[model samples]
Target: MHFVVCLKQVPDTSEVRIDPITNTLMREGVPSIINPYDAHGLEEAIRLKEKVGGKVTIVSMGPPQAKEALKKAMTFGADRAILLSDRAFGGSDSLATAYILSSAIQKIQETDPIDLVFAGKEAIDGDTAQTGPGIAQRLDFPQLTYAIKIQELTETTVTVERKTESGRQIVQAQLPALITVEKELNDLRYASLPNMMKAAAYEPEVWDVKSLSFDTKKMGLKGSPTSVSRIFAPPGRSGGEIMDGTKDPAATVATVVQKLFQQNIIMVNPLAKGGKS
Candidate 1:
């Protein structure tokens, strides 16, 4: 079995800021890290590879500096890493990003047939959980999203437990499928010394727009239909009023009730049998 994990580099949300004039993310000085959800997905993929003898490949689409993210992923025991970077890929929305990533994955499939593709449930920066499903649609693979656990895996099929609004659900899908994983799926392992040394010296293969067979119309900003009009921080909330009741509990209760009635926040009916005035 071959596993492909789609990874991403994102700004640390804690330090994220929006440019006041440009209304865009201020990423210049912000620190970057592997998307937390994607890290969990990658950890699960590596765990599965360890359980069953197989190869794990990591793929990401970003600027040239994104190779840093791929190298970090390689420390987790992935066999191969690929980075898709090109000026033509700049300003791509989720739809365009999925197109580029899917194209690269197809190119990779030419040499090594892929059995399963994994991705994070959503990217924190965008919080749009559309890329994974989009890739599945383009690859024509069965998509299992919000996966919490891989219950079973065989040569021909896979059974997974997924998170739902009410509870959990178990679903089975054929091979050559895509799964979007949640962080609860697995805990990440610390990289070994040897793996860290290897990652420090590793150079991931970089592919540009010319490397893949892609429709030029669907490659970059031109292919993206969505655009953010503006982004701003929400106003801070005011503190709530605090009342002291330890000294006089009954007095406090009566005061609160009277205030509620005076403010028209409560009503009473004099005609009812159990009515209060």
Candidate 2:
């Protein structure tokens, strides 16, 4: 089995700032780390590799600095790392990102057949949660999202427990499926000394636009259909009125109810009766 995990380097959300003029994230002088959800996805991929005896490869699309995120993933026991970086890929929305990633994955499959693809349910910065499914659509692979646990897996099929708003669902899909995982899927492992040393010295293979064949119209800002218009903090909430009922408790209750009714916060039932028989 050969698995590929998609990872991303994102600015630490706690310290992130927005450019008021451009309405984009201010990445300069901010610390970057492997996306937390992607880290969990990487952990699950490594665990599967350990159980099934296969190789895990990590792929990322970013600038040269994003190689740091790939190296970090390597410390978790991925066999290889690939970085898709090029000027043409700048300002790519989720759609363009998915296209670029799909192209890179197709290239990887030329030599090694991929059995499974792993990705986080959403990138923290964007939170659109569309890239994984987009890649699956492009590759014609079965897509599973919000997977919380893996129930079983074989050479031909894989069973998973997926989280949904209504409840949990047990789903099974054939091989060569793409799974976008929830952070609840797995906990990250501490890398061994040897793996850490290897990661520290590893240099990921970088593939630019010239290295991959992709449509020029389906990349970068030109391919992005959505753009942020403006960003501003919400107005601060004001303090609410306090009702003191220490003296006239019953009268105060009646007054509060009357105020609520006047404000339309509570509706009155004219025909309803409330009494003990």
Candidate 3:
């Protein structure tokens, strides 16, 4: 049950701003933290380790500063941490990012066969919710997204509850599966003094593009098929007339209803089914 948690360092929601020229996020100088959903994944991994007696490994792909995120995860009792950083790896889209992570996971598997891989549903900044599935696709592993709970795990199988728009679904997948977890999964535990001390002294294993025998064109911006042209706020709403309801409540209410009806803004739909109007 060697758990590998794929985490991302993201911009603080408050400090996130779009670059005018690049149409990309202005990530520089923004405070970073582990993706919230990934935190739940990390907690679940630690819990599994405690139950079954195994080690948890946390990994991330970002700029050098992302080591901060790895260190933070290490504080939460992860046995090892790794950071995949390289100048050539900058500006990677979800596909390219997943490719890099999948390669790292393969490298990790060479040393210790990975029983599971977990990731947040999506990064707050990207909000694509694509990387986890992408990684699972590349690795040829069964993927469970929006996982609420792991009902059971065994050497050959995994049963889990997944949250969906309709309701909870109980799903079973084969072993060596990848899961993209939701924030509602579980609450994180506080890091203890001993873990914190160890984490402060910990040095994350860093890997660059060359270290992975990566395809040059598929490494970074060159491999990314999508590009943001621009990002701007929606236009402000026009001022609306406020009905003078204070003068005569009944008259105002009647007038408003009459106006709405006249404008066909509150029409009764005769075709509505089940008498739902």
Candidate 4:
């Protein structure tokens, strides 16, 4: 069994700020880390590899700096890491990103067959929840999203508990499927000393556009059908008005009740002598 986990590097949300001028995220001086949900997915992939006795490979598409995220994933005992970094891939939307990642995964499959693909349900930065399914669609693989737990796995099939609004549901699918996992699915483990050392010394394979067979029109900003027009903070809440009940307590109460009734926040009592049904 061979598993390929898709990972992403994102700005630490705690430190994220929007630029007043550009109306975009202020990334400078902000630290980057692996997308938290993706970390859980990586953990699940590692656990599955440990159980099935196979290799776990990690893939990420980002700028050169994103290599740090790939290396950190390696510290979790992933067998290999691949970084898809190129200027041509910049400013890609979810659709274009999925295309680039799927192309890279196909290239990877040419050398080593991939049996399963894992990704986070959503990225912290985007939260669109479309990239993983897009990859699955392009690869023509069965997709399972919001998977909360792995119930069972066999050579030909996999059963999972999928999170839903009412409750989780059990879903079974064939092998070579792609799954997007929820953070509640698993706890991330601390890397062992040996794996830590290995990660420190390891360098991931970097692939550029020339290395993979991909349509030039389906990459970068040109390929993106949508773009963020502007990013701004939501307006700050205004101070609440105080309803003082000192001067005329009864009158204040009546005024407040009337306002509530006018706004339909509090329905008028039909049983009241003067109230209409």
lDDT of each candidate versus the true structure? 0.93, 0.91, 0.90, 0.93
Q: Residue 269 error for model 4, in Å?
A: 9.6
How many clashes (backbone N, Cα, C below 3 Å) per candidate? 0, 0, 0, 0
- When summed lDDT is taken over every stretch of 10 residues in candidate 1, the lowest stretch is 268-277
Model 2 lDDT tens row, 105-202: 99888989999999999999889999999999998899989999999989999899999999999999998999999999987899888999999999
User: Can you list the residue pairs that collide in candidate 2?
Assistant: none
Expressed as tens digits, the lDDT of each residue in 37-124 for candidate 4 is 8999899989988898899999999999999999888998999999999999999999999999999998888889988899999999
What local lDDT score does residue 45 receive in model 1, on the 0 to 100 scale? 90
Give the Cα RMSD of candidate 4: 3.0
Model 4 pairs in collision? none
lDDT order of candidates, top first: 1, 4, 2, 3
- Which candidate number maximizes lDDT? 1
lDDT of each residue in 1-277, candidate 3, tens digit only = 8999999988887788777777677777888888898899999999999998899998899989899898989888999998999999998999999999999999999989998899999988778999999999999999999999999989878788999999999999998999999878788999999999999999999999878878878868899998766787557898976888887999999888888888988986778996444
Query: Candidate 1, TM-score vs. the true structure?
Result: 0.92
* Model 1, position 161: C-alpha lDDT score: 99
- TM-score per candidate, chains pooled: 0.92, 0.92, 0.89, 0.91
Candidate 3 lDDT score at position 153: 88
How far in Å is the alpha carbon of 143 misplaced in model 2? 0.5
Candidate 1 wrongly placed segments (more than 4 Å): 250-277
Q: Give the true-structure RMSD of model 2.
A: 2.7
Better of 1 and 2 by lDDT: 1
Stretches of candidate 4 above 4 Å error? Answer: 238-257, 266-277
The lDDT, on a scale of 0 to 1, for candidate 2 is 0.91
